[model samples]
Target: VEMMENVSKYRYANVPNLDAQVVEIPYADGRLSMVMMLPNREGLHSLQTLFRDLSYSPLASTLASLRETELLLQIPKFSIESKLNLRPTLEALGIKDIFGFDANLSGILAGKSAQIGSVLHDAKIEVNEQGTVAAAVTGISVIPLMGSTMDTFRADRPFLFAIVDQSTGSMIFAGRVVQPTWAAPSPLG
Candidate 1:
C-alpha cells in the first residue's frame, strides 16, 4: 500500500441513479484524465449494476453536468494486470460464429476462410497521490449531476476508475480496484 494525500480543484459529480460519486483528476497536460467512480455507501453492487446498464448517451449527459469544486482526495496506491479470453463471453452474447468453423471473415481477409483463434484482452492500471498512470493493450474496449461546496473523497473501499482522453472523449483504460495488494513478479520480468 502507498500513501495518497492531496487537495485540489477538480470536476466532480454525485449520481442518484447509481448512488455514487465520480471525480475526474487530470493528467499533466490536462487533455487526459482519470475518473474515479465510487459508491457513497458501502458495497459496489450498485455501481456494478449501473455499469451493466451503461450507454454512451446517458454517460455523456452525466459528464456534461459535473461541476468544479475544491476536493480533499485520498486514493490508495495500487497496480493490477488482467487478461481475458473473450470467446466465452462473446458466445454467451449470441456471437458464436467468430469462434466456430463456419465463421466467415473473408471481407477483411480477402476471401480466406477465417475464424478468430483467441480474443485476448490485457489491461493494467496504477494510481497514487499525484494522479493515475494506466494502460490497456490488445483491447478494444460515468456520471452524474451535482453542485456542491468543498468535497472530500477517499477511495479506501472498492471503486471503479478510468483513464480517458478528454480531448476526444475516448476512454483509454478502466478497471476496478477491489483491494490493493502487491503484484507477483511477471514471468517476463
Candidate 2:
C-alpha cells in the first residue's frame, strides 16, 4: 500500500482493545481534522466491531480524548470513492413517489416534466502524510537510533480515518484502508 510517514506532534488516544487507537491531524485552520483509528488487531471482524462501537458512541468521545504527543507516524496514502444508488433506501423511507412517472418535479426542472430516475450519491477522499488530500504535507525529519524506544504509530495494517469539523464535532467524511488498490511509486521518491 502507498504510505504517508512522518515524525510530528499528533493528538492521540489509545481506546480499549475492542475499539482502536485514535490520532488527530488538524488542518491549517485548526477547525478541522483527519481523525485516524488504527485497530488493535487485524481482520474484518475487528473492523466490524470497531465500527459498531463507534456508531454506538459518537466519535466525539474519541475526539475529546486527543492530546498532543510526538511519535513516528506512518499511514497509508489512499483514495477511496463510493458511489451508492439510494433509490431503494429512499423508497423504503416513503419517498417512492419521486421516482414515479407522474411525479411532478417541474418546480425544480424549470417547468419540465422530470421524474427522479435514481438517487445516486458519490463521495471520494484522497489522503497522504499531509492532512487531507487538499491539505499540504508538513512532515518532520529526524534522525534516531534504530533500536531506540521512540513511540511509533504505524498504520501498516488495516485502519480507518475520517475528515471532521472540530468545532461542531461533525464527521464530514470517513473511509477505511484495508490494502493497496493499485501499485504506485512511493512519495519519498
User: How many residue pairs clash in model 2?
Assistant: 0
Off by over 4 Å in 1: 49-57, 87-117, 129-149, 180-189
lDDT (tens digit, per residue) of candidate 2 on 97-170: 78998998877888788788888999988775444622423444553579967667677777778889988999
User: What TM-score number comes out for model 1?
Assistant: 0.65
Residues 7-126 of candidate 1: C-alpha lDDT, one tens digit per residue: 556788786765778888777677888888887866667557656645523555556767887665566777789899988888889998888899888887986988898888988766
Q: List the candidate 2 regions with Cα displacement exceeding 4 Å.
A: 129-139, 147-149, 180-189
TM-score of each: 0.65, 0.83
